[model samples]
Target: MNNKLISIALTGLLASTSISSAFGTNISIVGRIQAEYSGINIEGFSSQTTVNDPTFFSSWGIRAFEDLGNGFRVVTMIDFGFNTNGGSIGNREVFVGISKDSLGTLKFGRTHSPFADFAGGWTIDPFVYTTLQATGSGGTMIASANGLGSGSYSAVNSVVRFTSTTFNGFSFAVLLMPGDADKLEAHLGGHLGGHGNNIGDTGGENGEWDVQFAAKYVMDFQSHKLEVFGGYSRDNVSSAQKKITAFNLKTEEVGRIGGVWSYKNFSLQGQYDFISKALGAATCSDAAALGAIGDVSTRQCNTAMNPGGDGSIWYAGGQYRLGNATLIAQGGMTDANKTDVFASRKSKSFTVGGLYHMSKRTNLFGGYQHVDVIDKNSIVDRDRNTWTVGMRHLF
Candidate 1:
């Protein structure tokens, strides 16, 4: 049954592409393919090795644009993500946007958040969307739950986002997500699972909204370049309106700041993420979180206890270009909210890697990461070590 449905959906997507092209819309296909050999060693578990794309680094998409004249254009992007090692195709980021030369762009549907765009995204994370990335896998950036707010790789759904035109290398982006879940949906937390068609994080069906906004400025000197960015994100739900009998679900709020400085062939980047009322899946296990070196499922803050929890994550990484190879080293820690009911779910990680640029669109990368995790229970405390070698090519 599922296979049949998937086949139908894929056919429809291809049909749409053909139909749109027939209407004089300019379309282009773009994406990348990444493959890696990964090995991991955990304190208690057996060492494991795999040839896979743990980061879902392989994807394809269609980008279409129709010139509306008068400096206006309509743009559409639909991306599909799949693991080269396994897993079926799934949606990555899908959105339609309107753009004007003088104004800006307004996007609707699932899209990247302001936090991922302006504040602390690829600019700060030298290895973003890769197996060695620091967002969810490395515990450097505090990720959101169910894509309700800003996360490194998660996209906001059912949202309206705007990006202003750059002026003097300064620009801003804003995102607004409306809650359309009812009481029943709120009880389920809107979308609890990782992926699929989810309306949006629960906003208690009350008059509440989720918002994220960020601004960035880039300054280039004769021999040095610097980029500064900051942003705030919030997911509000009325306690009185959506409170569950088992536990209190407070609002999730996040503040992010980061910057990058480059001189010659050397670059330094860092980001700090602060999260309050961190939410985690009730189904998360200590072993899973402890082993989340390159897994997004366990990338949340404090899952042992939600609501009222507060914590932060900070990352600092540097890159030095030596000929065609660039060396990378990054370290950061996640401090989960500590409480009497459970031990602090804190973890610290350091990653060292290098990328060999074979060409402008192809690179070979490898990295080693060590993580020390303190679980909610002392008995489950563990350490993780990971090594990966990968190659990626863009099309």
Candidate 2:
């Protein structure tokens, strides 16, 4: 089936390579794959050198567009991913949507949340969220791609994605994933991530629900670009709602704001996030029952405990093309989430690397990184240094 799609897409590409007409359709296949070895070390864990793709599984996808005249078009894409080391299919991305000169762009079927855009704009990006970079293995600064612990419990599966056409250097985008009582939210990389749902949120009978809303704006200048992003997500349960007995659950809410800047060969990005903890009578059950079933249970109005927290990250990076080689350097620090306890979480990472273009379709790259992590109580003060070399090919 994948081969057939690629074959048809290629045939389409060959049939309509020109685009001077107002009405036409074209298809293309695009993707990249890489291989590398990772030397990992944790606070007290054993160090190991493992070979695999650090950023993500190798994947490919087909993208097609059809011009419908009157400044409008239809766009569709689907990607299949597979692990390089294990050679097994992983996750996937699928979308089909339309765009217009005035209506903007909208697509459905499991897509990246608008917040995912914030993942790549500055130097820390592309790699900061990569599991191969400095503290990449720790998922330290990387929020859950599936919307698990994002913004306290904010964000929804952008199963429905929308992007506004650019106007005078400004553009906007949003995502919506509505569910029963519990809402779900997702973001980043156009991946099929996550959306939070309250337990037993079936229908609206219990008076419980969840919602996630996100938006982003990009400002383009003559020499650079700036993008602003913000989002909010929440889960609420009414006092009348109960699990096994009767009671109420604390409401959950999270908010985020930040942006990215790029000019010439330099780029910078940063963001701040806060989540309010789920606190209240907790459960309607007695202390013993609560103890037996846990502080959070399924009685009259019991819900999962929400540990609201705060996280901030920033990074600066640049590339200089010196003939066939592009020199790269990046340094950044993440103020870890510590909304509840002493919350003394912090991390710093520095890296230097180079990518040598072998041709239009391939590149050779190598780099080294230094990273440190400090937590509250300083229980685990793990530090690591990595040296890696790899190659990537685009097709």
Give Cα-based local distance difference scores for all models: 0.63, 0.45
Please name the candidate that would achieve the greatest lDDT relative to the true structure.
1
In terms of TM-score, how similar is model 1 to the real structure? Answer: 0.83
Give candidate 1's error at residue 35 in angstroms: 0.9
Work out how many backbone clashes candidate 2 has: 23
| C-alpha lDDT of candidate 1 relative to the true structure | 0.63
Q: List TM-scores for all candidates, in order.
A: 0.83, 0.65
lDDT of 2 by residue, 1-395 (tens): 11111122122122213233344567767565667665645445556565666444356777778987898888887666554776644434567889897868888765544444322322223333233342223222334323322211112333566777667655566555444434321111111111122211111224334444556677767978787776664544333232412112245455656666767655555555454532222101111010112212111111112233334445455555566676767666656444433354566777787767687555566777766655453455656556667766555
lDDT of 1 by residue, 1-395 (tens): 11111121122123223335777798877777778888877677787777877656577788888999999999888887777866764675799999997889999988766665456654466566555666555767654534543343356667899999889899998988776555313322321212222223344356567788889899989879898898888767544424553334567677878888888888888888787765443112111122343243233222223334677778898888888788889989878776433346777899998877787566788889887877665576667788889887766
Clashes of each: 0, 23
RMSD in Å for all candidates: 7.3, 10.6
The Cα RMSD in angstroms, rounded to one decimal, for candidate 2 relative to the true structure is: 10.6
